[model samples]
Target: MTAVQRPVPLSVLDLVPVSSGSTSAEALRNTVDLAAAAERAGYARYWLAEHHLNPGVAGSAPNIVIGAVAAATSTIRVGSAATLVGNVRALQIAEAFGTLTGLYGPRFDLGLGRSGAPAPGAPAPPALEPRDDEVVDGLLVPSPFAFRIAPGSRFALQGELLGRVPGDVERFDDELALIRDLFAGTYERDGQVVDGTPAAGADVELWIHGSTGGASARAAGALGLPYGANYHTSPGTVLDSVRAYREAFRPGVLDAPHVIVSADVVAADSAAAASELALGYDRWVHSIRSGVGAIPYPTPAWAREHPVDPAVAEAVADRVATRFVGDAGHVADRLAVLQRVTGADELLVTTITHDHAARVRSYELLAAEWGARAARPAAVEVA
Candidate 1:
């Protein structure tokens, strides 16, 4: 028998949620505290996500939040769960992340995604058409509707809110090309070279975050960049996305395919306690899905008293159901299964609760249990 490999690393994905009756300032402070805790707990990395115009989420600017977190912690990698590349220019992103890498050295990563980060009340863009060469289950296939953002949905309105003219937002592939060129110091427009000075030689790790088996996955594969599948957001498509990524993989920056999978998790001392902590999750998800934008995270008592409407509850049941909630051992068991199913090189856990203490404790418990499990030896029988 051969020796078993080391356990996959565990990381954190924080939304920096503002609880009911809490201010954004307080939410940001809590984010700093959580990052510090994650670093102390032996977690591999700490990532903040970008969400604009959401009252409950304080991470509207992930790069800024990343700077703050990096300052507060001495170790543990810091980065954006994603920077919503679609809303910003390639040169700007290249410079920003390059500067971050400069200050933080090898401890910074740049996670890019196509989210538009639309502001409230902005008009939505037309749905995206799938590429003709997209791969599905080991086959190259065309999906006319592979990616669709509903009209008037928050995501569809991102370009408008960012002051982009209708149809001005560059196609994702073109944007990626520009970003690569800028990073490699080969960017040119109209025969004039463009340079992203400090970022040109920065050794920052690039990861693509995607929820579908479309362009994002394919791009990451072909470029040999790490891919992060959003099981927390699109559980139904996680497998397909990872599959698409591995299938299209080519050796570039990375020698082989590397994938990280994100999940929703809430752990407590007991199953009952965990369930209580999770009560507010369904309602919180409802606010986002309803397209009115996310409201402040409600307290457990408030969530118990103000039950979600049946229709709204049904709409978000799949997401709520996928969340891992229980004691540390139970949650770890579930996460292990998820890792096995996804074949993820790393696991990114995101937890949102009304109480910041509970949220921090959840990470502590998970890290302890996960570390213990990884250290345990495989049982063997003498023949």
Candidate 2:
């Protein structure tokens, strides 16, 4: 078999939005426009994120957003950078993307996350609902229920349970088995149709997404899914989580275990311009450190006016140091190192710049930069 090339596919992790002063409708429109631009710019894929209760994050319903993006762009893939699986159920998710697949073909990827978006500074929840459960009758898909049926009586009685059911449930194996069976019934060979459409291809590429290791890696391995580590905001786990994923992986549907690391990136005409755009992200990070709610990207003037705490600013800088930034060449060099370090089959770039046009330009430049890097040979083995 031919070895996979290094400096892999460059993709965008978009949180589509208007600039700090723009409106929501405009943001949504801009998102569609941006996805189309990325497609034209030769980016491999454009993935949106699911963030709830944050005015700053416009891509809350990734599936809906993906639909818009996919519809607007012909060949560029559109996916969820990470969808909180706990908020949505498996059948719905399978159906949602299955429909997209039918519409867009091989250009859909499902990046699944377990935790909900917590307002910045909010404590991580005591418990998180896992993605695997979201697929079967175990956890209800996040969409509004189809009908007004009382909770446990209708669903549980019909031998279908959505969301967490109480009590002494079986172990992971049992849960996986049940989930598999349900998906099989809904989207497998003997698939059924709801509202007159067939359900098949639940075999969609499922990606395990997270900021940590252990359960996420083990679960993804056991289920034979791809894994994505959130290196953008959670840089510490970039390598360890990928290592765990590869070690725990067993060959199945995927030829081999693949890891995608998310990285924060900002590119501009000059180093000064890039750093200026990064100020918003730095402020966003500082707010996160102070336990303030997820704050909007500050204006260049605003960022300059309000200096962050020295410690907070340093912490932001350190985390972002792992980020790819600067003019195209500077950022591309960093991407090469990152792609080498994590053995990511793809690099998912997330830019936190508050300027809408700046954000779009940054991705366009990175896509062009990485497109050339992808042509060269580099070590593919995980470092």
Candidate 1 residue lDDT tens string, 1-383? 55544468999999989999999999999999999999999999999898876888888888889989998998899988787765676778888888887787778888888765443444444554433334333322233322334667665565467655443333667777777787788888789887678778777778888887777899999999899998888776777899999998999989999999998999999999999999888888878776666889999999889878898777776677678899999888777777777788999999999999999999999999999878888644454
Q: Pick the candidate with the highest lDDT.
A: 1
Worst 10 residues of 1 by lDDT: 138-147
TM-score of each: 0.88, 0.77
**Candidate 1 ranges with C-alpha deviation above 4 Å:** 1-6, 116-157, 165-170, 189-193, 379-383
Model 2 residue 226 distance off true place after TM-score fit, in angstroms: 1.5
TM-score of candidate 2 versus the correct structure, residues matched by position: 0.77
lDDT of candidate 2 vs native?
0.66
- In candidate 2, what residue range of length 10 has the lowest lDDT sum? 138-147
